[model samples]
Target chain A: MDSANERTAEEVAWIHRIGQGDKAALQLLYQRYASRIFRFVIRMIKDEAKAEELVNDVMMEIWKSAASFEGRSSPSTWILGIARFRTLNAVRGKKLDTVELSQAPEAVDEGEDASTGKSQEQLRALMRQSIARLSDEHREVVELTFFHDCSYKEIAEILQCPENTVKTRMYHAKAKLKPWLKNMGLAEAELGGVT
Target chain B: MTEQRMDELLAWYANGTLDEAERQEVEAWLENNPDAQLQLAEYEFMQQSVAELGDDEPVFNTEAGLDNLMTRIETEEAANEAVGQQSTSTMLERLQNWLDETLNWNRTPAFARVAMVSQFGLVLALGVVLLLPSETNEGYEVLSGTTPAVIAAGPTATIGFNVDTRLVELQQLLREQQVVIVGGPSAIGTYQIELPKDDLVEARLAALKAHPAVIYLQRNEP
Candidate 1:
């Protein structure tokens, strides 16, 4: 078997052991997925402490539900899906103020300067800000696609949304990102010599 | 395709996930649309920049979090044991209950129910693949003398192999582990192959490293 299949099988095996009450298997799982989950949750909640707590909550949910993992999606997809729901719930439960995505400025005058001539780090900072300004749904889709390298189908599974919804979110996300990238002049800089 | 459909295809195009035919179509579309091509480049640049955002940067300490999880799992396990369940049937019973509650198959929209059932079928098919006997009872053959023998139990790594290695050859080498190509050589020359994850990950890595055809091995992170 190739590595991806092997990893999936290993995850299934871990879930099986977890079903049998194997703490070691659960630990292996924690080692495998915690960081990724942390990054994802941190993006969603934007609170280090809360994200940390939610990560544990997610692992706990997995610990309790590992037995029911049907291998329909990859273990990572399942875990992240669980984390997404938990993070959204935590956000709602806390009544946190999410940015009104519609209010995001179309032009970033200051970011444009950084994009055209600034270092890659500066451009990345701009990108991060652009991501932060996205609506929750758009941002999640963008993060899954760009940072996690998930396919549309995987993102759908993670978000429990339809693939077309994923595509639409991504399209709107890019639309939101476009003006920011344009303002930064980052896109122009990157593609300056392309055509 | 409409403008909106083309826009969606552009995202896939920049990601290098588009198949050859789709890619060709996108490329053809781009020929007359330099603006779209620029957008594609911008998307590619954006993706790469985003990927670099969290490069080995420590997010937060999870050791304590893991400890808490272990504690809860132990607590739950002990409580269940105190109930004195001997047969594995109880585990299966609990799993069934959880599945019913989680999927809520009865109330889920028709589309979700279909996805759930399809996923179940795929898993069952995989289980059958794993159970089938191969040249080695453990399910994989060591392609070279230097390759260490490993007993397949659970867990798998998705290794990217050289482009020249044929799929049929991989099937012969992989044996009981299903050799599914999940991803590709893209701009870089690598074929992402999925195999059953098992204890013999190290052995498998060593075997692949020793094999002349394996290009790169990466463990898929969820």
Candidate 2:
């Protein structure tokens, strides 16, 4: 089997053992997923403490509901779905969406001139700022696609949206990032002829 | 595929998650449209950049998280076990009392008393065996009124109020039904309420269910 399928198989097995009240299995699952879940949640909510709390909550939920998992989706997908649900709830409860982008710290240093010779790190920082500026829906599509390594279908599953919507969001996200890429000295032709 | 469609698939292509057919289609398109190669290269760079975004962020302390979760699981299990033990103890006591009242072993002859005692021993042993905690019985208790105390007290129901339901309005409604909130606002925002008396449980439940604020309600099954 491919690596993804093998990972899924291993996760499923751990979940089964967890269902049997095996703490070791739960620990193994936690070790595998806690960081990933935290990263996704921290990106979503932008709160480190809440993200850590949610990671624990998600793991605890998996422990409680392991037996109920029928394997309809890959374990990673299911776990991410749980994380997304919890993070959304927390976001709604706190009205975190009201937080303005202007309040967000800039990713790029103002002292560094983009036109002058820039280091790779500076370019990456600018890229991060461009990405961080995208709307939540668009940024999520980008994050799930590139960072999480999820396919369109898996992204759809995590976001509970249509696959076409995922694709469209990614398209919009890239379109929004194009100007920033151009400003960062990338050639226009290199940006896929995107308007 | 159209250029827009191919553009949409480029991210997945760079991520190497496209199916073989889709991969081939993208490859063929790229072969014909050589300019698309730069776009594909840009996508690969975007992926690398996004992946590295977390590199500067604080690392999640997995061991600490696991420790916290384990502690929570242990506490929850302990609470559930206590409830189960209490239930079992109450059941055993009730069984013993019923046997005493029915058999009246103290008033019987010596031989008859001995036989009755032996039978009571067997019955108690069976009760203990049956009531031992099982896999299905252990863990979080979803229903609040399933406990022995709640079961003996009165009827209860789980209700989910509308998010927009006003506090005063909810109070008036619960006051009319003579029920008090017992547990929850669970993960799904459902609450467990205990009714005043079991006499008009069905009518009280119907009234509660009919309330405009009562979006969801389930009668607690003991």
Residues B73-93 of candidate 2: C-alpha lDDT, one tens digit per residue: 999999999999999899988
Q: Pick the candidate with the highest DockQ.
A: 2
Best by TM-score: 2
**Candidate 1, residue B48: CA error in Å?**
2.5
Give DockQ per model, in order.
Answer: 0.24, 0.31
Candidate 2 residue runs with Cα over 4 Å from true position:
A96-99, A107-115, A188-195, B32-34, B54-56, B90-222
Candidate 1 per-residue C-alpha lDDT over B1-222 given as tens digits, one digit per residue, 9 for 90 to 100: 677787787777776656688788878788867687787877876787677754423466668878877777678778878677646667988877887798765577988878878999999999999987655332222223232334444443445566688877777666634455544333454544555565666676677666766766765432
Whole-model lDDT for model 2 versus the true structure?
0.81
> Which lDDT tens digits does candidate 2 get at residues A1-195?
998889989999999999888999999999998988988888777678888999998998899899998999889889999999988988898776522467555654433445368776777766877787778898888888888889999999999999999999988888877766656656644455442
Recovered native contacts, candidate 2: 0.64
- Name the TM-score of candidate 1: 0.58
Which 10 consecutive positions of candidate 1 chain B have the poorest summed lDDT? B138-147
